[model samples]
Target: MPAASALVDLENLRHDVDDALDRHLTRLRDEVAATGPGTTALTDQVSTLLAGGKRLRAAFCYWSFRAHGGASSGAARDAVVRIGAALELFQAAALLHDDVMDASDTRRGRPTAHRVFEARHRERQWSGDADRFGTAAAILLGDLCLVACHREAGAALDALPTDVGRAARDMLDAMTSEVVVGQYLDVLVQAEAWGLDPTADEDRARLVLRAKSARYSVERPLTLGAVLAGASPDRVAAISAAGLPLGEAFQLRDDLLGVFGDPEVTGKPAGDDLREGKRTVLVARTLAAGDDDARLLVTKHLGDARLTDDDVAALRAAITGSGAVAGVEALIDELAAQGLSALATADLDAHGREVLTGLAHAAVDRAA
Candidate 1:
């Protein structure tokens, strides 16, 4: 499997993209500066979350726009870039809040923004409990990013024709709403231990994964760009046909990496999702395999952070023996193939087809 970020030119693009984001972050800092150092802390928190990522969503939006006949150097292109940047800002908001919701301490191999802020509260011996301080700071910072996302998006859309501007706004609204709904479903599913039947649970997990990650990450971004570029209804449907399966494959690959990837490469601890009791399709399938001892091992150690190396090894053995690993891998191949077939049917320019093809391969073959 290739790395999640392996396809792009990171060094060259990073400098330009970072410069754009830095200006945005500086603006955020200046706006918050009057609120005192604590607000500045929040600004830094947002910047940190925004600083690193594959920038896949942004690139997808930009390229899709261009491939759909958006202008290269005119207002259309600039609007597309700003729209992409807005997507990145929205991602920052999601990650900040997601870390809090998941109680995840790390993101991209660093302390999550909330944790970083909370630690500062502790070292400074602030007035409130550090945990509470951290949570509050993180939530506020997340909200800030959400607002910034809209503001940036508005500025971007201002350059477009009124119809395109309205369409862009609608896309942003729908994307936000869908992701939040999916997120709520995810939290509710995990909180209630809702999946007990192996097949049923696995199905639900797959749906949740699609709604929460795949659509927002790939499908919607591509469609949004296409819509802004004035896609016909048939054209929009064609793009979606290609994007949905590919997006599913993308998340399935991510699920695989979450369980089996090397920490050094993935920047996430091995079996972290298992420890988090993520209720992924993989776990559902393992449970459904109906191995009593395997089920027992999962029930006992699945979400226990105190689980040792031996415990994780045992859990891995149980999962593998359950035949879920092979099943999931097969599903990944099926979804990727479905996407490629859909792309073949879509009315696409050469460049659009190429980009989607590259994305499909990169997504499914990704190690992280």
Candidate 2:
């Protein structure tokens, strides 16, 4: 129907997913517009949320399909593209709800959806609390995106044989449910007290990080790709085994970026994790290793909303001075090595192994 690249190239895979997202959102826009023009903003906000993703999950799926010897241009490839777009939209839904939960101000260098909606409410002098309205609207937007994700995945699966499709859909459902549960785990960890036992804190943080990020971001996608490609249970397991470690390293990099990354590049403010008092592994390690003064700095400033530039600086100093940064970096390197070693164990073709090796580096070595 339209000119498109059907190759399995990574960059082209991103473009193909974007095209699918555009098609899905166009349908969403038309459907929403049918209700009324006022509802268009909901679709618009979802659109905004979908922009600027790294599409690492999509890449994993696409290449996993390729790695499993799935065809480059055919029904399977197209189905994987739809599934990739579904993953990206699902990620969008997660971000929408996550920002509201974290009370975040920015995403991908733009004001967050809730914040944007809140500003619109204030400007229009809406009656209710602007903050509450924003939260409600953003939540509903996330729900809509979640629905769209399922629909896309279902449609993509329809093209395959029934049994394979059913299993892939099961994987999709598991990924979705696991992420929600993991998010709740994250919330639970953040709300309760910590620092009593560094071991417990690190264990809890690892659980949250793996559930909320590692599995969803990498392992599930890779496993799902293998499933969609009609790989056997053992093959799927192998893919997940290889992907999980890389996923952990990826999230660890994200945790590092949260505290030390530039706002301009990361699209979130500096010291975001510190201000949020994430109780991350980094924080846990700092508490374990820091001198009393560094520990005091962490206790005083972590999660303080009124934190200033100087306060952020001091906190950063404390974290680095405590040696958590280097510790985390070393851990990241170790995990990356483990993932690559696992990948080597998989019976991948040469090209597949090469691509996956590249992706492992890209996932773990990124700045954003």
Candidate 3:
């Protein structure tokens, strides 16, 4: 764990990032207000979603910049904060679309955007199908968020040196493209799970984890910060190496939480991933390693949209009894170790090293 001061510093950074996001969104709202009342809901929905998040990406970006000897005051610090805000907006866009794609009902313990819109339609006795209307609205809101993300990043990067700005922009572009492709792969895997090569399930899941979650959530943010700071190539590589494994472990922990964590702690329903039939590494391992009866149990209920509580309980048992839970725990430990080891060799200040180590611990050893 980091010293109290380090933890406080991280918290302060989170507050700064939040303030930046609020200011950016307010400006956006003012600009869009001139268009019409129709867009207000979109901005409101985005604002609501952005209101609550771990802000891990922003923390990683800020600390990475500091680790590479970037200035921590004046315009430099403010520019980094704006870049962090951009990352938050990107995350908002991803979540908005992800909830719709997963047909999820809730997020952060509230009705998902689509579900909220659906209820609004039903209450108003709108003339069309409520579900469709909700989906359309959510999609448009997601698109708007994506545009905002790019715009925010562009503005922040404009304040940097030309080479640094171009590097950050390129990385951001790649990050966005990777996430979209990874998301498509996720949808494809879910659809093809029944016929997917069982031998390749783990590999495929890992690829999706790296692309969809790890890089976007950790590596790219760190790399972007390093780039912005004009870090040496070797130094940038070291940070990325550290971040990638930590990021994967972060997602792996999330996979376990999705099935087994307390809903109150995770801010999501238990077994929601099972309901969505997520072809996660844990699920793939269970399918590959479980006995015949266990396999049958998982196959029968894994993707059932109308899964009852009992069904979820049974599936949970099947997954656990098959030893897949322990397997995933082991993997998380290994990845966390790998990530921490990389950090040991990283050319960073004492504070940077401690904070990154603390973040790795927080990323993996969490209930949510």
Candidate 4:
């Protein structure tokens, strides 16, 4: 391995992203604090949210940058690290708003930001509807994170050459827009009927996944890094080819985790996705099996706000018995293989390729 590979290693990437985020957020917190006492709440919550991620996005961006010959040290490397920080900030924004939309009570084993604010309101006997107050607060906080994301990104892009910087800036702007559209699509699907056509249901779910996560979480990060490195269209195209499938697999793993993941590990209630009535590809597969009973089970309990442990157990059994879990796992494996295959042929740094392979596996094979 070239010594430069060490700079993009997962551990090093995490440290770099975190360090950059800390510095940026600390300054932000101070700025908010300047407004008056307790004004730092938003920045505090952001800081806390930024602390827990695995930095997968950062890893993807950094490794692709090194692989496509961006830079390994000095100013260019710092710009890349700042870009990674911007990605993390955007992710934090997503988590905050997602919790509010899903009415999620916890995240990463802690009270979701809205819930935390809500509890404080109750404790203080505050006037106005505490629930509404909490929701609004979280939403504003999410908005702040969005602006902060743009700020970090703009600063970093300004440091690069105009052409490459413009390319990366465009990518970052599109990523935000795509994620917002995907979020609405997800909400719309949850509000409407599913399984009317299994194939359509799966396709719609995949569409939402691709826009909401696959591209933003995986493909764009890779492309952004490669673009910053001034990668030829051929190289950028190759990276995207690998990214899309791997990104699909990455989100598929998340779908599985949403239903089956342990709360201890995932920091959310078990079967929370079911409670939220997510029409994931897994749910589509169960219906696709043409099992009426499975369909009935999903229809009855999948989105029940008052679902109990027993109800969750029944739903799990129905899903597993219909072979949906296995089916999804099989798809994950196949998609991962396709991504790895595409990656195999890419002309890039040897060490970067090897690390990317490991990162891909690590992304798909995880407990939370």
Candidate 5:
């Protein structure tokens, strides 16, 4: 028997997910190849977007399947991994479009796809304005990603049982639609003319976080995996119970990183979220505290590209002083605790439970 180690065996599972993504991408690229010559940029953008990430959603999907008695033999696990890969592709699509919508220049520590293409166009002295070139390229790239996600998902379920295929399709549909709606809400909130109640603003942000980020990150993937594996509704519910809180904690940590993490580590500039005026739950809560000076500081400094270091320092102090930092930290702890408790009592297999517990710790405890 293999000796037990302190770490979970999720590495092997990660490889499986990677392999599934590779296969699906290969077929997708082939389809793109059949297109006209000038469309090569489209194919390259698709590959670039797929090239990197932590693959958190894929991990969740695989674990959910294993938790629900999914056999690892042959293609059973691979099928679930493929579904997870499709989720990642969907995310890439959302992000590509999101960068364009947000006018973001950077992503994952590099020029966003549109920015890269736009820069290329300028260097080559292309006919159109660089800004328009970037926007057009990003929009097309995002659309291609969306199409690939559906094609990959359909191919994954093509050989599965009818019931399983139906469940997977339903999850894909809901995830796609909800994420788009959440993105719209995020964009509208940035405009800050919604006339929403002050008290409800943070709650609304939380709702968007849950639906847009958290569900796609963990909850929906887990539920979809269990459904595909024919797990009981009760079992599926338990997996969601374990996934949702943990996922939220993950995003809470992300919110903190967006404001404070090192650029070297987070692949984003310091205070990028503030510079973008992202209406994160943390910022919303800080505003809710209604501190007069803090409000003024945020209104003036937040989202300003030309903000000085002193301004960032002041804003950080305001956030910390307003108790929003500590409040969010408390919420992270609570959510992590609740997720672990659910794992302990969940009906999942012992290995699944243990792996998930370790993942929860890593998700919430990491610096980045």
Candidate 6:
């Protein structure tokens, strides 16, 4: 296929995934409504949250299946789309829980789910602490999304060969386990930063990146697709090798954006990561390379929830002056090059190669 047509095909696949999610969510909402009107709010919240992402996970899964000689049409292609939708639903659950954990105020340019629920409580004049109510509701909603994820993925897997189904399910299970563990580590890192030794900062940050973001965001999704396509172990390994570095680069870029990206582009407040005291790779690098003054600046303001605009500006200056941003950019370039090289050498179809290459660039080089 021509490059333009290949790009069009990928876009169409993304739309199909969206349509699948819509249909699934509609069915869920209707089912819940039959149980109780109040219970349907969970589905409503998830549907709204799932509507706005770039769907990068789905694209990676779709193209990876194509790369592994999966059928392009009929029930096989539709099953892949369903799997993609399942990934999206799982992601939504993660994001909802993550926002609550981070005390995040916004997501995809809208109020976070917990905050939305809190506002709803206030609006209704409910008889409880609005914040607590919101947090509880968001947590339940996240759990509901997880159940939905399993249901969606199970149905898709049922259509695959037994071995492929087993492998895909295993990948999904691993992805979820890694993300949850990563999130716990993230919480621990922040809570223990003061007591922990500074020397392990970079290592800890990389560990969190791999677990919380990298594998689920790219590597596992690609491998899951390959598995569903009945690719050999060697093929899955090669795709994962390519995907891991790309996934790392993707999270590194996200770390950069979390600290320095424009709120308009990133759909979050500027300096939100700093406010939350996220021990990102950039911050670790800055701490390692910065002078005493820079270290003092970070110590004073890194986790200050009441940070003023001036404080944020000063912290930004300290981070920039430490050259950590430059270091991360260099790392991103290096990792991206490694990933592209792997893709170039991998035994994939010409169109799959082209789309995966584009996805690699999109993952690491986007503003959001």
lDDT tens readout by residue for model 2, 1-368: 11112223444787789899999999999999999768999998887778777777888888888888888898989999999999998999999998888888889999998999999999999899999999999999999999999999999999999998999898889988989999999999988988889889999999999989899898998988898888888888898888998999999999999999988889999998887778799999999999999988898789887789899999999999999999999999999999999898997767767787787788888678
- Candidate rank order under lDDT: 2, 4, 6, 3, 5, 1
Task: Mark the regions of model 2 whose C-alpha exceeds 4 Å error after superposition.
Answer: 1-11
Off by over 4 Å in 1: 1-17
Per-residue lDDT tens digits for candidate 1, residues 185-262, read 889788766436777787788888888888878888888778778878788787787778888888888888878888
Which residue pairs show collisions in model 1?
none
Steric collisions counted per model = 0, 0, 0, 1, 1, 0
Pick out the ten consecutive residues of candidate 4 with the lowest summed lDDT: 1-10
Q: Where does model 6 exceed 4 Å of error?
A: 1-11, 194-198
Q: Which structure is stronger by TM-score: 2 or 5?
A: 2
Question: What Cα-based lDDT does every candidate model obtain?
Answer: 0.79, 0.88, 0.86, 0.87, 0.79, 0.87
**Native RMSD of candidate 2 (Å):** 3.3
Give the least accurate 10-residue stretch of model 1, judged by summed lDDT.
Answer: 7-16
lDDT tens string, model 4, 1-368? 22333434544776778888988888898889998997787887887787778788888898888888766787778888899999989998988998999998888989999988898889999999999989999999999999999999999989888998998998999999999999999999887778788999999999999999999888988888899888999999999999999999999999999999999999888999989888899999999983788889897787787999888988999999999999999999999999999889997798778877777777777789
What's model 3's lDDT at 193? 41
lDDT of 3 by residue, 1-368 (tens): 76433552564787788888888889889888888876777788888898878777888888888878888786767788889999999999899899999999989888899998999899999899999999999988888889998998888888878888888888999999999999998888887745246669998899989999999988888888888788989999999998999999999999999899899987888899999888888888888888898889888788778988888898998899889999999999999999999988899877777777776787778887
TM-score of 3: 0.96
Global CA lDDT of candidate 6, please?
0.87
Cα lDDT tens digits for candidate 5, 127-161: 96999998998998898889888887898888788
Per-prediction TM-score: 0.94, 0.96, 0.96, 0.96, 0.93, 0.96
Residue range 207-279, candidate 6, lDDT tens digits: 8899999999989888888888888999999999999999999999999998899999999999988998888
